[model samples]
Target: MTTDAETAVFEEHRPVLMGVAYRMLGRVADAEDVVQEAWLRWSAADRAGVREPPAYLVRITTRLAIDRLRQVKARGEAYVGPWLPEPYATDFGDTVPDTEERAVLADSVSLAVLVVLESLSPLERAVFVLREAFGYPYAEIATMLDRGEPAVRQLAGRARRHVDERRPRYDVDPAQRRDLTERFLAAAAEGDLAGLMDLLAPDVRLVGDSGGKAQAPLRILESADNVGRFLVAVGGKSVPDMSFRFLELNGGPAVLVLSGGMPDSVFQVDVSAGRISSVYVLRNPDKLRSLASA
Candidate 1:
Protein backbone atom coordinates (compact mmCIF):
# COMPACT_ATOMS: atom_id res chain seq x y z
CA MET A 1 0.00 0.00 0.00
CA THR A 2 1.31 3.44 -0.94
CA THR A 3 0.88 6.26 1.52
CA ASP A 4 -0.62 9.57 0.35
CA ALA A 5 2.57 11.38 1.27
CA GLU A 6 4.65 9.00 -0.77
CA THR A 7 2.23 9.40 -3.71
CA ALA A 8 2.52 13.16 -3.51
CA VAL A 9 6.28 12.92 -3.72
CA PHE A 10 5.98 10.77 -6.85
CA GLU A 11 3.48 13.14 -8.46
CA GLU A 12 5.74 16.11 -7.85
CA HIS A 13 8.59 14.54 -9.80
CA ARG A 14 6.46 13.05 -12.56
CA PRO A 15 7.14 15.78 -15.08
CA VAL A 16 10.90 15.42 -14.91
CA LEU A 17 10.67 11.66 -15.09
CA MET A 18 8.39 11.91 -18.12
CA GLY A 19 10.79 14.33 -19.75
CA VAL A 20 13.77 12.01 -19.33
CA ALA A 21 11.86 8.98 -20.50
CA TYR A 22 10.28 10.66 -23.54
CA ARG A 23 13.56 12.13 -24.71
CA MET A 24 15.19 8.74 -24.45
CA LEU A 25 12.48 6.72 -26.23
CA GLY A 26 11.09 9.32 -28.71
CA ARG A 27 7.56 7.98 -28.23
CA VAL A 28 4.97 9.17 -25.75
CA ALA A 29 3.47 5.74 -25.19
CA ASP A 30 6.82 4.16 -24.47
CA ALA A 31 7.81 7.02 -22.21
CA GLU A 32 4.55 6.81 -20.28
CA ASP A 33 5.06 3.09 -19.90
CA VAL A 34 8.52 3.64 -18.50
CA VAL A 35 7.23 6.27 -16.09
CA GLN A 36 4.46 3.97 -14.91
CA GLU A 37 7.00 1.25 -14.32
CA ALA A 38 9.08 3.73 -12.37
CA TRP A 39 6.06 4.58 -10.25
CA LEU A 40 5.58 0.93 -9.42
CA ARG A 41 9.22 0.59 -8.42
CA TRP A 42 9.15 3.78 -6.37
CA SER A 43 6.04 2.67 -4.53
CA ALA A 44 7.58 -0.66 -3.61
CA ALA A 45 11.10 0.50 -2.79
CA ASP A 46 12.61 0.65 0.68
CA ARG A 47 13.05 4.35 1.37
CA ALA A 48 14.45 4.36 4.89
CA GLY A 49 17.89 5.47 3.68
CA VAL A 50 16.82 7.33 0.52
CA ARG A 51 17.65 10.92 1.29
CA GLU A 52 16.85 12.26 -2.19
CA PRO A 53 13.53 11.12 -3.57
CA PRO A 54 13.89 13.09 -6.79
CA ALA A 55 17.25 11.56 -7.60
CA TYR A 56 16.08 8.10 -6.59
CA LEU A 57 13.01 8.33 -8.82
CA VAL A 58 15.05 9.73 -11.68
CA ARG A 59 17.51 6.85 -11.45
CA ILE A 60 14.75 4.31 -11.74
CA THR A 61 13.16 6.13 -14.69
CA THR A 62 16.43 6.58 -16.57
CA ARG A 63 17.46 2.98 -16.13
CA LEU A 64 14.07 1.77 -17.31
CA ALA A 65 14.22 4.06 -20.32
CA ILE A 66 17.71 2.81 -21.21
CA ASP A 67 16.60 -0.80 -21.02
CA ARG A 68 13.57 -0.04 -23.17
CA LEU A 69 15.75 1.82 -25.68
CA ARG A 70 18.15 -1.09 -25.91
CA GLN A 71 15.29 -3.50 -26.47
CA VAL A 72 13.83 -1.27 -29.19
CA LYS A 73 17.21 -1.01 -30.95
CA ALA A 74 17.81 -4.72 -30.78
CA ARG A 75 14.51 -5.44 -32.50
CA GLY A 76 15.62 -3.33 -35.48
CA GLU A 77 12.05 -3.02 -36.63
CA ALA A 78 11.70 -1.68 -40.14
CA TYR A 79 9.38 1.30 -40.15
CA VAL A 80 7.58 2.42 -43.23
CA GLY A 81 8.93 5.61 -44.79
CA PRO A 82 10.77 8.23 -42.76
CA TRP A 83 10.09 7.99 -39.02
CA LEU A 84 9.87 11.15 -36.95
CA PRO A 85 9.57 11.34 -33.19
CA GLU A 86 5.98 11.54 -32.01
CA PRO A 87 4.97 15.17 -31.65
CA TYR A 88 5.19 15.98 -27.94
CA ALA A 89 2.82 18.61 -26.60
CA THR A 90 4.77 20.97 -24.35
CA ASP A 91 3.63 23.84 -22.14
CA PHE A 92 6.47 25.28 -20.12
CA GLY A 93 4.03 27.93 -18.90
CA ASP A 94 5.10 29.54 -15.59
CA THR A 95 7.16 26.57 -14.47
CA VAL A 96 10.20 27.70 -16.43
CA PRO A 97 10.65 31.34 -15.43
CA ASP A 98 14.12 31.81 -16.84
CA THR A 99 14.08 32.51 -20.57
CA GLU A 100 17.50 30.97 -21.08
CA GLU A 101 16.67 27.75 -19.26
CA ARG A 102 13.35 27.53 -21.04
CA ALA A 103 15.08 27.87 -24.40
CA VAL A 104 17.56 25.12 -23.53
CA LEU A 105 14.77 22.75 -22.49
CA ALA A 106 12.78 23.52 -25.61
CA ASP A 107 15.77 23.04 -27.91
CA SER A 108 16.65 19.69 -26.38
CA VAL A 109 13.16 18.35 -27.08
CA SER A 110 12.75 19.88 -30.50
CA LEU A 111 11.94 17.57 -33.36
CA ALA A 112 15.24 18.41 -35.00
CA VAL A 113 17.27 17.52 -31.90
CA LEU A 114 15.25 14.41 -31.12
CA VAL A 115 15.79 13.19 -34.69
CA VAL A 116 19.53 13.52 -34.17
CA LEU A 117 19.33 11.92 -30.74
CA GLU A 118 17.84 8.82 -32.34
CA SER A 119 21.28 8.02 -33.70
CA LEU A 120 23.09 8.05 -30.37
CA SER A 121 23.62 4.91 -28.33
CA PRO A 122 21.33 4.31 -25.38
CA LEU A 123 23.89 5.31 -22.74
CA GLU A 124 25.00 8.33 -24.70
CA ARG A 125 21.40 9.44 -25.17
CA ALA A 126 20.72 9.04 -21.43
CA VAL A 127 23.78 11.10 -20.55
CA PHE A 128 22.85 13.83 -23.01
CA VAL A 129 19.26 14.04 -21.80
CA LEU A 130 20.27 14.19 -18.14
CA ARG A 131 23.20 16.59 -18.46
CA GLU A 132 22.15 18.87 -21.29
CA ALA A 133 18.40 19.08 -20.79
CA PHE A 134 18.17 18.84 -17.01
CA GLY A 135 21.64 20.21 -16.07
CA TYR A 136 22.43 17.35 -13.73
CA PRO A 137 25.95 17.36 -12.34
CA TYR A 138 28.31 14.75 -13.77
CA ALA A 139 28.80 13.12 -10.38
CA GLU A 140 25.07 12.84 -9.86
CA ILE A 141 24.53 11.38 -13.31
CA ALA A 142 27.28 8.82 -12.71
CA THR A 143 25.63 7.79 -9.49
CA MET A 144 22.27 7.46 -11.26
CA LEU A 145 23.68 5.32 -14.04
CA ASP A 146 25.97 3.28 -11.78
CA ARG A 147 28.98 4.23 -13.90
CA GLY A 148 32.29 5.87 -12.96
CA GLU A 149 32.16 9.65 -12.93
CA PRO A 150 34.96 9.81 -15.49
CA ALA A 151 33.17 7.36 -17.75
CA VAL A 152 30.00 9.42 -17.52
CA ARG A 153 32.03 12.50 -18.43
CA GLN A 154 33.37 10.72 -21.50
CA LEU A 155 29.89 9.65 -22.57
CA ALA A 156 28.61 13.19 -22.13
CA GLY A 157 31.51 14.56 -24.17
CA ARG A 158 31.02 12.09 -27.01
CA ALA A 159 27.24 12.64 -27.03
CA ARG A 160 27.68 16.41 -27.08
CA ARG A 161 30.13 16.22 -29.94
CA HIS A 162 27.92 13.88 -31.92
CA VAL A 163 24.83 16.07 -31.42
CA ASP A 164 26.72 19.28 -32.21
CA GLU A 165 28.05 17.84 -35.43
CA ARG A 166 24.79 16.33 -36.65
CA ARG A 167 21.90 18.41 -35.30
CA PRO A 168 20.65 21.23 -37.50
CA ARG A 169 21.37 24.68 -36.09
CA TYR A 170 18.11 26.61 -36.33
CA ASP A 171 17.26 30.12 -35.29
CA VAL A 172 15.85 29.94 -31.74
CA ASP A 173 13.68 33.03 -31.66
CA PRO A 174 10.13 31.96 -30.78
CA ALA A 175 8.51 35.05 -32.25
CA GLN A 176 10.31 34.59 -35.54
CA ARG A 177 9.36 30.95 -35.76
CA ARG A 178 5.72 31.63 -34.94
CA ASP A 179 5.53 34.46 -37.44
CA LEU A 180 7.00 32.30 -40.18
CA THR A 181 4.71 29.44 -39.29
CA GLU A 182 1.67 31.68 -39.64
CA ARG A 183 2.94 33.04 -42.93
CA PHE A 184 3.76 29.56 -44.18
CA LEU A 185 0.32 28.35 -43.22
CA ALA A 186 -1.31 31.21 -45.08
CA ALA A 187 0.73 30.58 -48.20
CA ALA A 188 -0.07 26.90 -48.20
CA ALA A 189 -3.78 27.46 -47.57
CA GLU A 190 -4.01 29.90 -50.47
CA GLY A 191 -2.03 27.64 -52.79
CA ASP A 192 0.56 30.35 -53.19
CA LEU A 193 3.56 28.46 -54.58
CA ALA A 194 5.71 31.55 -54.96
CA GLY A 195 4.82 32.65 -51.44
CA LEU A 196 5.76 29.22 -50.13
CA MET A 197 8.94 29.22 -52.21
CA ASP A 198 9.86 32.64 -50.88
CA LEU A 199 9.84 31.33 -47.31
CA LEU A 200 11.76 28.11 -48.03
CA ALA A 201 15.51 27.93 -48.35
CA PRO A 202 16.91 26.89 -51.68
CA ASP A 203 17.96 23.55 -50.18
CA VAL A 204 15.02 23.13 -47.84
CA ARG A 205 14.12 19.55 -47.03
CA LEU A 206 10.69 18.15 -46.13
CA VAL A 207 10.58 14.98 -44.07
CA GLY A 208 7.12 13.44 -43.87
CA ASP A 209 6.31 10.63 -41.46
CA SER A 210 3.15 8.77 -42.42
CA GLY A 211 4.35 5.25 -41.63
CA GLY A 212 2.66 4.34 -44.96
CA LYS A 213 -0.66 4.74 -43.15
CA ALA A 214 -1.49 8.12 -44.60
CA GLN A 215 -0.70 10.29 -47.57
CA ALA A 216 2.83 11.72 -47.22
CA PRO A 217 6.11 11.63 -49.04
CA LEU A 218 7.56 8.12 -49.01
CA ARG A 219 11.03 9.60 -49.32
CA ILE A 220 12.41 12.90 -48.10
CA LEU A 221 11.72 15.71 -50.54
CA GLU A 222 14.43 18.32 -50.98
CA SER A 223 14.82 21.63 -52.80
CA ALA A 224 12.49 24.60 -52.45
CA ASP A 225 10.77 23.88 -55.73
CA ASN A 226 9.91 20.28 -54.87
CA VAL A 227 8.80 21.01 -51.35
CA GLY A 228 6.83 24.04 -52.39
CA ARG A 229 5.04 22.12 -55.11
CA PHE A 230 4.18 19.32 -52.74
CA LEU A 231 2.76 21.70 -50.18
CA VAL A 232 0.67 23.43 -52.81
CA ALA A 233 -0.71 20.12 -53.94
CA VAL A 234 -1.50 19.03 -50.43
CA GLY A 235 -3.08 22.33 -49.62
CA GLY A 236 -5.31 22.25 -52.68
CA LYS A 237 -7.07 19.11 -51.62
CA SER A 238 -10.27 19.58 -49.67
CA VAL A 239 -10.42 18.07 -46.21
CA PRO A 240 -14.01 17.98 -45.03
CA ASP A 241 -14.52 20.48 -42.22
CA MET A 242 -10.77 20.98 -42.11
CA SER A 243 -9.34 23.53 -39.72
CA PHE A 244 -5.96 24.54 -38.31
CA ARG A 245 -4.69 25.41 -34.85
CA PHE A 246 -1.29 26.69 -33.79
CA LEU A 247 0.24 25.16 -30.71
CA GLU A 248 3.69 25.12 -29.16
CA LEU A 249 5.06 21.67 -29.73
CA ASN A 250 8.56 20.59 -28.77
CA GLY A 251 9.23 24.21 -27.72
CA GLY A 252 8.16 25.97 -30.94
CA PRO A 253 5.09 26.81 -32.97
CA ALA A 254 3.44 24.08 -35.06
CA VAL A 255 0.30 23.83 -37.16
CA LEU A 256 -2.11 21.09 -36.19
CA VAL A 257 -4.48 20.15 -38.94
CA LEU A 258 -7.85 18.82 -37.92
CA SER A 259 -10.42 17.07 -40.09
CA GLY A 260 -13.93 16.71 -38.79
CA GLY A 261 -12.62 17.82 -35.39
CA MET A 262 -10.07 15.05 -35.27
CA PRO A 263 -6.30 15.35 -35.52
CA ASP A 264 -5.30 14.87 -39.15
CA SER A 265 -1.68 15.92 -39.16
CA VAL A 266 0.99 18.12 -37.58
CA PHE A 267 3.40 20.45 -39.39
CA GLN A 268 6.50 22.14 -37.96
CA VAL A 269 9.42 23.87 -39.63
CA ASP A 270 13.05 24.50 -38.76
CA VAL A 271 14.29 27.90 -39.83
CA SER A 272 17.85 28.99 -40.55
CA ALA A 273 19.19 32.24 -42.00
CA GLY A 274 15.61 33.54 -42.16
CA ARG A 275 14.46 30.73 -44.42
CA ILE A 276 12.72 27.46 -43.73
CA SER A 277 15.49 24.83 -43.68
CA SER A 278 13.48 21.74 -42.85
CA VAL A 279 9.76 21.01 -42.78
CA TYR A 280 8.40 18.10 -40.74
CA VAL A 281 5.01 16.60 -41.51
CA LEU A 282 3.65 13.95 -39.16
CA ARG A 283 0.56 12.21 -40.51
CA ASN A 284 0.80 8.82 -38.90
CA PRO A 285 -2.48 8.26 -37.10
CA ASP A 286 -0.79 6.34 -34.32
CA LYS A 287 1.48 9.27 -33.57
CA LEU A 288 -1.37 11.77 -33.71
CA ARG A 289 -3.61 9.87 -31.30
CA SER A 290 -2.40 11.71 -28.20
CA LEU A 291 -2.75 15.09 -29.89
CA ALA A 292 -6.42 14.58 -30.61
CA SER A 293 -7.49 16.17 -27.35
CA ALA A 294 -5.02 19.02 -27.68
Candidate 2:
Protein backbone atom coordinates (compact mmCIF):
# COMPACT_ATOMS: atom_id res chain seq x y z
CA MET A 1 0.00 0.00 0.00
CA THR A 2 1.30 3.50 -0.96
CA THR A 3 0.51 6.92 0.40
CA ASP A 4 -0.24 9.97 -1.76
CA ALA A 5 2.97 11.65 -0.60
CA GLU A 6 5.06 8.68 -1.74
CA THR A 7 3.46 8.67 -5.18
CA ALA A 8 4.10 12.38 -5.51
CA VAL A 9 7.70 11.89 -4.54
CA PHE A 10 8.13 9.31 -7.31
CA GLU A 11 6.56 11.62 -9.85
CA GLU A 12 8.79 14.51 -8.74
CA HIS A 13 11.87 12.45 -9.30
CA ARG A 14 10.83 11.16 -12.73
CA PRO A 15 12.52 13.99 -14.68
CA VAL A 16 15.75 13.62 -12.78
CA LEU A 17 15.76 9.89 -13.43
CA MET A 18 14.95 10.48 -17.07
CA GLY A 19 17.84 12.92 -17.27
CA VAL A 20 20.15 10.39 -15.70
CA ALA A 21 19.04 7.61 -18.00
CA TYR A 22 19.20 9.86 -21.06
CA ARG A 23 22.77 10.83 -20.33
CA MET A 24 23.69 7.23 -19.62
CA LEU A 25 21.97 5.61 -22.63
CA GLY A 26 22.29 8.56 -25.12
CA ARG A 27 18.90 7.69 -26.55
CA VAL A 28 15.60 9.13 -25.36
CA ALA A 29 13.59 6.02 -26.25
CA ASP A 30 15.90 3.73 -24.35
CA ALA A 31 16.07 6.19 -21.45
CA GLU A 32 12.30 6.32 -21.27
CA ASP A 33 12.16 2.54 -21.22
CA VAL A 34 14.72 2.45 -18.43
CA VAL A 35 12.80 5.02 -16.43
CA GLN A 36 9.55 3.16 -17.02
CA GLU A 37 11.11 -0.02 -15.72
CA ALA A 38 12.40 1.90 -12.72
CA TRP A 39 8.86 3.06 -12.02
CA LEU A 40 7.61 -0.50 -12.17
CA ARG A 41 10.21 -1.61 -9.66
CA TRP A 42 9.40 1.34 -7.42
CA SER A 43 5.68 0.67 -7.49
CA ALA A 44 6.21 -2.98 -6.59
CA ALA A 45 8.30 -2.08 -3.57
CA ASP A 46 7.04 -2.16 0.03
CA ARG A 47 6.86 1.53 0.85
CA ALA A 48 6.17 1.31 4.60
CA GLY A 49 9.65 0.28 5.49
CA VAL A 50 11.44 2.25 2.79
CA ARG A 51 13.13 5.62 3.28
CA GLU A 52 14.88 8.10 0.97
CA PRO A 53 12.73 7.45 -2.09
CA PRO A 54 14.81 9.65 -4.38
CA ALA A 55 18.02 7.80 -3.76
CA TYR A 56 16.17 4.48 -3.93
CA LEU A 57 14.63 5.28 -7.33
CA VAL A 58 17.94 6.54 -8.67
CA ARG A 59 19.63 3.30 -7.68
CA ILE A 60 17.00 1.31 -9.53
CA THR A 61 17.32 3.48 -12.65
CA THR A 62 21.11 3.40 -12.64
CA ARG A 63 21.29 -0.38 -12.35
CA LEU A 64 18.77 -0.88 -15.11
CA ALA A 65 20.66 1.57 -17.33
CA ILE A 66 23.94 -0.22 -16.79
CA ASP A 67 22.37 -3.55 -17.74
CA ARG A 68 20.82 -2.00 -20.83
CA LEU A 69 24.16 -0.46 -21.80
CA ARG A 70 25.70 -3.91 -21.82
CA GLN A 71 23.08 -5.10 -24.27
CA VAL A 72 23.44 -1.93 -26.36
CA LYS A 73 27.19 -2.49 -26.59
CA ALA A 74 26.73 -5.91 -28.18
CA ARG A 75 24.12 -4.52 -30.54
CA GLY A 76 26.43 -1.70 -31.68
CA GLU A 77 29.02 -4.18 -32.87
CA ALA A 78 26.58 -5.29 -35.58
CA TYR A 79 24.94 -1.94 -36.28
CA VAL A 80 24.54 -0.88 -39.89
CA GLY A 81 26.86 2.11 -39.75
CA PRO A 82 28.37 4.64 -37.40
CA TRP A 83 25.94 4.76 -34.51
CA LEU A 84 24.51 8.16 -33.58
CA PRO A 85 22.42 9.12 -30.56
CA GLU A 86 18.72 9.47 -31.12
CA PRO A 87 17.54 13.11 -31.40
CA TYR A 88 14.67 14.48 -29.37
CA ALA A 89 12.33 17.32 -30.30
CA THR A 90 12.10 18.65 -26.81
CA ASP A 91 11.22 22.28 -26.37
CA PHE A 92 14.31 24.13 -25.20
CA GLY A 93 12.25 26.12 -22.71
CA ASP A 94 10.60 23.07 -21.22
CA THR A 95 13.86 21.23 -20.69
CA VAL A 96 15.99 24.16 -19.55
CA PRO A 97 13.82 26.99 -18.40
CA ASP A 98 16.66 29.44 -17.89
CA THR A 99 18.53 30.77 -20.92
CA GLU A 100 21.92 30.20 -19.33
CA GLU A 101 20.85 26.77 -18.13
CA ARG A 102 19.73 25.86 -21.66
CA ALA A 103 23.20 26.40 -23.05
CA VAL A 104 24.82 24.21 -20.40
CA LEU A 105 22.22 21.51 -20.93
CA ALA A 106 22.62 21.66 -24.70
CA ASP A 107 26.38 21.43 -24.58
CA SER A 108 26.19 18.47 -22.25
CA VAL A 109 23.82 16.67 -24.60
CA SER A 110 25.89 17.25 -27.74
CA LEU A 111 26.26 14.30 -30.09
CA ALA A 112 30.04 14.53 -30.00
CA VAL A 113 30.16 14.18 -26.23
CA LEU A 114 27.70 11.32 -26.39
CA VAL A 115 29.86 9.63 -29.03
CA VAL A 116 32.88 10.03 -26.80
CA LEU A 117 30.85 8.56 -23.97
CA GLU A 118 30.28 5.45 -26.07
CA SER A 119 33.98 4.73 -25.84
CA LEU A 120 33.80 4.49 -22.06
CA SER A 121 33.16 1.17 -20.35
CA PRO A 122 29.75 0.78 -18.73
CA LEU A 123 30.98 1.45 -15.22
CA GLU A 124 33.12 4.33 -16.35
CA ARG A 125 30.19 5.94 -18.14
CA ALA A 126 27.92 5.52 -15.15
CA VAL A 127 30.46 6.98 -12.77
CA PHE A 128 31.07 9.95 -15.06
CA VAL A 129 27.38 10.73 -15.47
CA LEU A 130 26.56 10.38 -11.82
CA ARG A 131 29.49 12.45 -10.69
CA GLU A 132 30.11 15.01 -13.43
CA ALA A 133 26.61 15.54 -14.79
CA PHE A 134 24.45 14.98 -11.75
CA GLY A 135 26.95 16.00 -9.06
CA TYR A 136 26.59 12.80 -7.05
CA PRO A 137 29.11 12.48 -4.24
CA TYR A 138 31.68 9.74 -4.63
CA ALA A 139 30.48 7.96 -1.49
CA GLU A 140 26.93 7.83 -2.79
CA ILE A 141 28.06 6.81 -6.26
CA ALA A 142 30.28 4.09 -4.79
CA THR A 143 27.38 2.67 -2.87
CA MET A 144 25.20 2.76 -5.99
CA LEU A 145 27.82 0.80 -7.94
CA ASP A 146 28.60 -1.48 -5.00
CA ARG A 147 32.20 -0.39 -5.20
CA GLY A 148 34.60 1.12 -2.70
CA GLU A 149 34.82 4.92 -2.62
CA PRO A 150 38.40 4.94 -3.89
CA ALA A 151 37.46 2.70 -6.83
CA VAL A 152 34.53 4.91 -7.76
CA ARG A 153 36.68 8.04 -7.63
CA GLN A 154 39.26 6.39 -9.88
CA LEU A 155 36.59 5.35 -12.34
CA ALA A 156 35.16 8.86 -12.54
CA GLY A 157 38.61 10.43 -12.82
CA ARG A 158 39.53 8.10 -15.67
CA ALA A 159 36.30 8.85 -17.48
CA ARG A 160 36.81 12.60 -17.02
CA ARG A 161 40.33 12.47 -18.41
CA HIS A 162 39.19 10.48 -21.42
CA VAL A 163 36.36 12.88 -22.15
CA ASP A 164 38.54 15.94 -21.66
CA GLU A 165 41.07 14.65 -24.14
CA ARG A 166 38.58 13.83 -26.91
CA ARG A 167 35.73 16.23 -26.31
CA PRO A 168 36.16 19.78 -27.66
CA ARG A 169 35.49 22.61 -25.26
CA TYR A 170 32.07 24.12 -25.93
CA ASP A 171 30.83 27.71 -25.77
CA VAL A 172 27.18 27.73 -24.73
CA ASP A 173 26.00 31.18 -25.75
CA PRO A 174 22.80 30.32 -27.62
CA ALA A 175 22.70 33.47 -29.73
CA GLN A 176 26.31 33.17 -30.77
CA ARG A 177 26.02 29.47 -31.60
CA ARG A 178 22.79 30.15 -33.45
CA ASP A 179 24.44 32.85 -35.53
CA LEU A 180 27.38 30.66 -36.41
CA THR A 181 25.05 27.82 -37.33
CA GLU A 182 23.09 30.11 -39.62
CA ARG A 183 26.20 31.22 -41.43
CA PHE A 184 27.34 27.63 -41.84
CA LEU A 185 23.97 26.49 -43.09
CA ALA A 186 23.64 29.31 -45.58
CA ALA A 187 27.14 28.64 -46.89
CA ALA A 188 26.44 24.92 -47.26
CA ALA A 189 23.00 25.32 -48.80
CA GLU A 190 24.32 27.70 -51.44
CA GLY A 191 27.31 25.49 -52.28
CA ASP A 192 29.75 28.27 -51.50
CA LEU A 193 32.90 26.31 -50.82
CA ALA A 194 34.93 29.38 -49.95
CA GLY A 195 32.29 30.61 -47.57
CA LEU A 196 32.13 27.23 -45.97
CA MET A 197 35.89 27.15 -45.62
CA ASP A 198 35.89 30.60 -44.07
CA LEU A 199 33.51 29.47 -41.37
CA LEU A 200 35.22 26.09 -40.76
CA ALA A 201 38.35 25.69 -38.72
CA PRO A 202 41.55 24.42 -40.31
CA ASP A 203 41.26 21.08 -38.54
CA VAL A 204 37.51 20.75 -39.03
CA ARG A 205 36.09 17.26 -39.22
CA LEU A 206 32.73 16.25 -40.62
CA VAL A 207 31.00 13.14 -39.32
CA GLY A 208 27.92 11.96 -41.17
CA ASP A 209 25.41 9.39 -39.96
CA SER A 210 23.34 7.99 -42.82
CA GLY A 211 22.60 4.55 -41.40
CA GLY A 212 22.90 3.32 -45.03
CA LYS A 213 19.55 4.85 -45.81
CA ALA A 214 21.17 7.91 -47.39
CA GLN A 215 24.56 8.75 -48.84
CA ALA A 216 27.23 9.69 -46.30
CA PRO A 217 30.92 9.29 -45.78
CA LEU A 218 31.48 5.84 -44.37
CA ARG A 219 34.28 7.21 -42.21
CA ILE A 220 35.07 10.50 -40.50
CA LEU A 221 36.42 13.11 -42.87
CA GLU A 222 39.29 15.29 -41.62
CA SER A 223 40.52 18.67 -42.87
CA ALA A 224 38.55 21.71 -43.94
CA ASP A 225 39.08 21.21 -47.67
CA ASN A 226 37.82 17.64 -47.64
CA VAL A 227 34.78 18.51 -45.55
CA GLY A 228 34.05 21.54 -47.74
CA ARG A 229 34.25 19.55 -50.96
CA PHE A 230 32.02 16.85 -49.57
CA LEU A 231 29.48 19.43 -48.51
CA VAL A 232 29.52 21.02 -51.94
CA ALA A 233 29.07 17.71 -53.72
CA VAL A 234 26.17 16.75 -51.49
CA GLY A 235 24.52 20.15 -51.68
CA GLY A 236 24.65 20.17 -55.49
CA LYS A 237 22.05 17.49 -55.62
CA SER A 238 18.35 18.25 -55.22
CA VAL A 239 17.68 18.25 -51.51
CA PRO A 240 14.35 18.98 -49.99
CA ASP A 241 13.93 22.59 -48.98
CA MET A 242 14.55 22.46 -45.26
CA SER A 243 13.59 25.06 -42.70
CA PHE A 244 16.46 25.63 -40.35
CA ARG A 245 15.20 25.72 -36.80
CA PHE A 246 17.84 26.34 -34.18
CA LEU A 247 17.41 24.25 -31.09
CA GLU A 248 19.43 23.75 -27.93
CA LEU A 249 21.54 20.63 -28.63
CA ASN A 250 24.02 18.95 -26.34
CA GLY A 251 24.40 22.17 -24.35
CA GLY A 252 24.98 24.24 -27.48
CA PRO A 253 23.21 25.55 -30.53
CA ALA A 254 22.10 22.87 -33.01
CA VAL A 255 19.94 22.93 -36.07
CA LEU A 256 16.99 20.57 -36.39
CA VAL A 257 15.71 21.16 -39.88
CA LEU A 258 12.66 19.52 -41.41
CA SER A 259 12.79 18.12 -44.91
CA GLY A 260 9.90 16.62 -46.78
CA GLY A 261 7.71 17.35 -43.79
CA MET A 262 9.76 15.11 -41.49
CA PRO A 263 12.64 15.59 -39.13
CA ASP A 264 15.46 15.03 -41.62
CA SER A 265 18.62 15.42 -39.57
CA VAL A 266 20.47 17.23 -36.79
CA PHE A 267 23.61 19.33 -37.17
CA GLN A 268 26.01 19.84 -34.27
CA VAL A 269 28.58 22.57 -34.63
CA ASP A 270 31.84 22.56 -32.73
CA VAL A 271 33.08 26.12 -32.64
CA SER A 272 36.61 26.94 -31.56
CA ALA A 273 38.21 30.40 -31.47
CA GLY A 274 35.15 31.76 -33.30
CA ARG A 275 35.40 29.21 -36.15
CA ILE A 276 33.43 26.02 -36.59
CA SER A 277 35.88 23.29 -35.65
CA SER A 278 33.66 20.33 -36.50
CA VAL A 279 30.28 19.61 -37.97
CA TYR A 280 28.34 16.43 -37.22
CA VAL A 281 25.49 15.73 -39.58
CA LEU A 282 23.14 12.98 -38.41
CA ARG A 283 20.91 11.81 -41.28
CA ASN A 284 20.15 8.32 -40.12
CA PRO A 285 16.39 8.14 -40.65
CA ASP A 286 16.00 5.62 -37.89
CA LYS A 287 17.78 7.91 -35.46
CA LEU A 288 15.64 10.82 -36.51
CA ARG A 289 12.40 8.95 -35.80
CA SER A 290 12.18 10.18 -32.23
CA LEU A 291 12.70 13.77 -33.29
CA ALA A 292 9.95 13.29 -35.84
CA SER A 293 7.64 11.86 -33.22
CA ALA A 294 8.39 14.85 -31.03
Best by TM-score: 1
Residues 1-294 of candidate 1 have per-residue lDDT tens digits of 789999999999999999999999999999999999999998888977789999999999999999999999999999999999999989999999999999999999999899999999999999999999999999999999999999999999999999999998889988888999999999999999999999999999999999999999999999999999999999999999999999989989999999999999999999999989999999999999999899
lDDT of 2 by residue, 209-292 (tens): 887887778888999999999988877877587666777555666778788768877887877788888888888877777676
Shift of residue 206 alpha carbon in model 1, Å: 0.4
Predictions in order: lDDT: 0.96, 0.81
Error of 1 at 287 (Å): 0.2
What are the clashing pairs of model 2? 106-250, 106-251, 106-252, 107-250, 107-251, 107-252, 109-250, 110-250
Model 1: worst 10 consecutive residues (lDDT sum): 41-50
The whole-model C-alpha lDDT of candidate 1 against the native structure comes to 0.96
Q: Ten-residue segment with the worst summed lDDT in candidate 2?
A: 87-96
